[model samples]
Target: MNVFILGLGNVGKALADTLRAQGHHVEGSTTTPAKVESLAQHVDKVHVLRGDESEKLAEASQSADVLVVCVAPDVKKTRTKEEREQHYQQVLEESCKSAANACQRVIFLSSFSVYGDGGEGQEPISESTPTANHDEPSSKYYQRAENHVLASSHGCVLRFPDMYGAPGDLSFSERVKMAIDYFGGNAIFGADAPLYAIHFEDVVASVVHAINEELSGIFNVCDDDNLPASNQQVFDAICAEHGWPALTFLNQIKAPNRKISAAKIYQSGYRVKHPDPNLQYLS
Candidate 1:
């Protein structure tokens, strides 16, 4: 099958690589010329697309069996709030239009952030859970994108959990560093807060399975473990793996409200390639 992946970010590139490795024709698009060359190393073709350009969007989306929208607004300090939101909304609209016109199946990369604070005791969030439009500026934009894709008849939305793994670029190491710097080598969260994550390899496998099966609908993609652990526990795991100092945990900190159940994807005969999140860091 021929697949076109829009937004050549970490996740998008991973998906393209996985598909190509499985003998599927894969094409990808990136906003940066440099990234285009990088992506070309993994897929058959790479198109440099300006996020605001409608023609590029149509061209990329119009000639594929499956279209995956993985473009996400940078949460880092690259653009102003309004600028970021406008760019994301425009990309969402353009991508959706292109996909609807050409692609038989569309897969959207969405975030569990749409679920917002899962509230106290919300152990494992399913596709049925009512989502909260997070108050955070970035999360709000993702929620809007999720809504746009799901409203389409041919779109499949994957509400991804916190994804982490190899390739360094997409790992949790940077996040660990940031937390340590901010909290003086300490991180905090409630003891019962459910923490969710998916390995990069597993993410790719799920996408491959969905495309091969032409699965449509919203599915929460996450690990089987829904048990909540403190930020300190996560930090310690990384620290121990990397031979660093363990961070302290503050009991007063509440866990972020986001956890997803991947049971639906599993029941669809999609097995995760990397079941253990901890093994991802070690590998």
Candidate 2:
């Protein structure tokens, strides 16, 4: 099969490499020309392209058996609430629309943030969970992207948790240090709320699984065994391991404060390599 990835970041690169190893012709796109040569090392071809460019995407992906949207807005590149919202919405919606036009099958990578705070209790979140916090800019943009994807018979949406295990991943230990440096023991993010995570390799595997099985609709792919532990607990554990002081938390009520389960995908024939984030809690 010929696979074309819209973005070639860590997760994208991983999937491209895997597909190539499986005897598929892989092509990837990058926003920067300098990265073209480097990205080509893992795939048959690389394109210098933009997600919102429907014509370019149509041309690049026309021959692809599957078009995967690995592109995500670089929130750091923009300032202001309006700018952030616009960037996210455009990148996601445009990519989905373009991918739908380009190929028979389109896979859009989405975040669990669509659920906002989560289920708030013990029950694991499924694909049907309410994507709360429609008030937030990120949620609004994600929903738009998701809607665009689901609108297509060939499109599918994968809802993932905080993806770790990438080279630049902000792991649990890193978050602990960040709390000390940035918040100065004042508080940890999602201090009192639940947090779920996914490994990068598993992310790649899930995509492959979906493509092989011709999956459609929305699916929540995340760790279930090593599920929701308050960021405060993990932070405290890591801080204690290093003899660091604890931070004060506001004890705020976060919406969508729920654990996510990948059972739907599992039953549909996809399984994650890492279902527990406890390993990060140690490191």
Candidate 3:
């Protein structure tokens, strides 16, 4: 199989490495030219281009059987609401457009932030759940991004929460420290909301499953087999352990408030390698 991955971040690089190890022809993209040599260790070919570079993407993905979009907004560049929305349009929405145009099969790595506190009821967030209707930039642009891919004949959208359990990713403690150092201990997520999350390996597996099964439509990809601790539970422990200020939630739930279900993907024969969120967290 010829696989082309956009945005060679932690997830994209992992996916590229996995696919390459499986004897597939893998091509990947990186915005930084300096990383091309490093990225070549994982992928057969590396294209240097931004996510919004449709022409370059189209050229690079010409022979690709699947185009997996793993582009993430640069957090350092997106501090304000306007900046975030614009960044999403470039990385998520525009990149999906380029992916759909370049490859017949499109798999998008999306965020559970699209669900945005979900509906009023206490039901678990499933594939059938209505997306966010509010103006939150991540939610709005991610929804738009999903639309572009789903418009194709064969498209898969795997929505995940904050992925952890990877050496390259920031630990829950580091995240709390970052919040304190940069954002004045304020958080966008609600304190009481359960932290719906997945392991880094499971995220890669889910994308591979989507490609192997030729899946279409939306699916919530997370560790649904085990219960999760709330933000308060995890953050409080991290703060106390580190002797840092506790994070203050804005009462805005960017993720699922109650529980998030991955039963749809499970029914499709995709099993999560790591299902316990409690084990994954530091707390």
Candidate 4:
């Protein structure tokens, strides 16, 4: 099988390598030329191309068996709110068009942000839950992006929670720094707020599971636990171990604070390799 990945970021590279190791040929695209060297280590072929580049997409996607889109918008690059939204929307639309035209099947990796902090409901977010982010640009683009891929008859969507463990990713260590810098060594959200997240390895495993099972439609890919510990619980443990002043939890910022479910994936013969985030988040 020839797997073509549109982005060679952490999740993309992981997926490419896993498929390659499983005796499938993999090709990938990266926005930066410098990263091609590292991406080449994971896939058989690497192409340096922006997500919206048509000719490049044509070449890289040639003879693709399945095209997995893992492109993430660099929201910091743009200065204004409008620019940010337009940039992401444009790139996603172009990528979707290319994928629909170039590949026989498409797999899209999406974020849980589309659920919009799980809204006022205390129930865990599930695949059946309607997206509640149509107002905000950052959260709303995911809907537009997902729509693009789903337009394809053979498209599959995998929605994941916070993916940690990759370099530069917001893992526990970075969370500590963020605790100090962003939160004044405190938590803006409530201490007991539920934090739905997933380890990077589990993310890769779930993607592989979906591909292997040929599953389609929306699937919320999260850890086995629908309700995980609060951000304060996880951060406080780390803060205490390091002798750093434990972060004071307050209702300063409003963010997602509820359980996220992955039962749909489990019922589909797809089990998370790392079902518990507590086992991996600390490391």
Candidate 5:
């Protein structure tokens, strides 16, 4: 299958490389020309195109057997609520329009943030979990994008949990390091707050499986374990692996906890290569 992956970020690049390694023709698109040189190393071809340009995206989509949109908006940037919403809305509209025109199968990368504040209860969130569009701008934007993709024909929305692995480029360890430097310790959360994670390789496998099966609809692409480890547990794991001091918890932080179930995808006959979260550390 010839797959065109839009947005060559860490996840996108990984997916393209996996497809190419499996003897498929893979092409990738990046917003910057500089990334094209590096992306070409893994994909059969690379295009320097932004997700907002409908014409360029449409042309690229027309040539692909499967179109994957992995673009993510920067949520940390200081911007007005309207400004942030507009940024995501524009990208969602343009990307979906282009894919609808040229691709038979579309995979839109979404986030679990759509399930806003799974507050005060422990529930196994599935693909059918009810979502509320809260005042949070990021959650609203992702909900919009997910809705757009789901409404499209042959579109499969993969709601990914926090992804981490050996790629070493954007691992949780790196983020933890930054947090420690800024706060003088590991970030703390409630002991029961779950940390849903997916290995990078398993993420690629799930996407490839979806493309091959032409499965349409929404699927939660997360590890089977769904270990809801606390922030301290994560810090301990990192410290144990890297030989660092254990972090102290400052205060109990209550976060929205959701146990993402991958049963829907598994029922589709796609096996996950890594079901244990600990295996991610081995890499």
Candidate 6:
């Protein structure tokens, strides 16, 4: 199989490496030219291009069986609404349009933020759950991105929560420390929102399963069985353990507070290797 991965960041890099190891002809892209040499060691080819570069994406994805769009928004650049809109337009919407145009099979890497607190209930979010119409940048643009891909018959959207268990991922404590020191406790997400997350390993597995089984439409790829610890619970424990001040939240409900069900993908025979978050108690 010929696979083209757009955005050679952590998730994209790991997916590319896994696909290559499985004997697929993998080609990936990175916006940073400086990272090309390092990324080249993992895939068959590397293209230095941004998501909005339609010509480059189409050219790079030539004869590719699948095009995985995994672009991430530049958080530093998205401080205002205008900045967020422009960044997401280029990163999510435009890239997805290019991917859909370039390949018949388009798999988008999306976030659970699309669900937006999952209403007022604790019901597990399924693929059928109506995506909340929040004004947040992530919720809005991610839905726009998902639409572009799902517009095609073979398009697939795999939605995940906050990702961890990867080589490049920061530990939960490190994230809290950064929030306290760097952002001055203005954490974008709500403190009390249940912190549902998925391992990077499961992320790779879900994408591979979608490609191999020709699965289409949306699937929530998360560890839904266990009770999720809220961000406040986790971060407060981390801060207390390290004798640091608690990180503050903007009280923004960016992601689904409700547990997200992966039963749809499981029914399709995709096993989540890391079902338990294992961080059962932070303190």
Model 6: lDDT of residue 52: 82
| Number of clashing pairs per prediction, in order | 2, 9, 0, 0, 1, 0
lDDT of 4 by residue, 71-153 (tens): 87763443345775787676666786677677758888887767766677767767887787575565577777788788877
Whole-model lDDT for model 5 versus the true structure? 0.70
Candidate that scores best on lDDT: 3
lDDT per residue (tens digit) for residues 148-228 in model 1: 566766678887766777475545666777656765765533434445667777777787788888788888777655444
Cα lDDT computed for each candidate against the true fold: 0.67, 0.77, 0.84, 0.74, 0.70, 0.83
Poorest stretch of ten by lDDT in candidate 1: 250-259
Per-model TM against the reference: 0.77, 0.86, 0.94, 0.82, 0.78, 0.93
lDDT of 1 at 173: 65
How do all the candidates rank in terms of TM-score, highest first? Answer: 3, 6, 2, 4, 5, 1
The global Cα lDDT (0 to 1) of model 2 is 0.77
Q: Which scores better on lDDT, 2 or 3?
A: 3
Off by over 4 Å in 2: 78-83, 119-123, 176-189, 240-255, 279-283
10 residues in a row with least lDDT, candidate 4: 75-84
Better of 1 and 6 by lDDT: 6
lDDT by residue for model 2 (1-283), tens = 9999999999999999998899999998999999988888988999989988889989988889889999887744433457766787788777777777777678989987788676556677788777876755666777877887787787899988667788887867776676577656554135756656778999899999888888999998875555567767776887788888876764322335555678888788777776556555555
For TM-score, the strongest prediction is 3
The residue pairs in collision within model 6 are none
Q: Per-residue lDDT for 1-283 in model 3, tens only?
A: 9999998888888898888888889999998999989888989999999778889999999999999999887766665678877887888898998888888789999998888887699778888888984587888889988998999878989998888887667777888898888877888677877876678889999988888788998998876677688888888888887788889987543767788888999999997777665444463
Task: State model 3's lDDT.
Answer: 0.84
Clashes of 1: 2
For residues 97-164, write the lDDT of model 5, one tens digit per residue.
56655666778877776776454456677778776545555566667666666776788998876677
Pick the winner on TM-score between candidates 1 and 5: 5
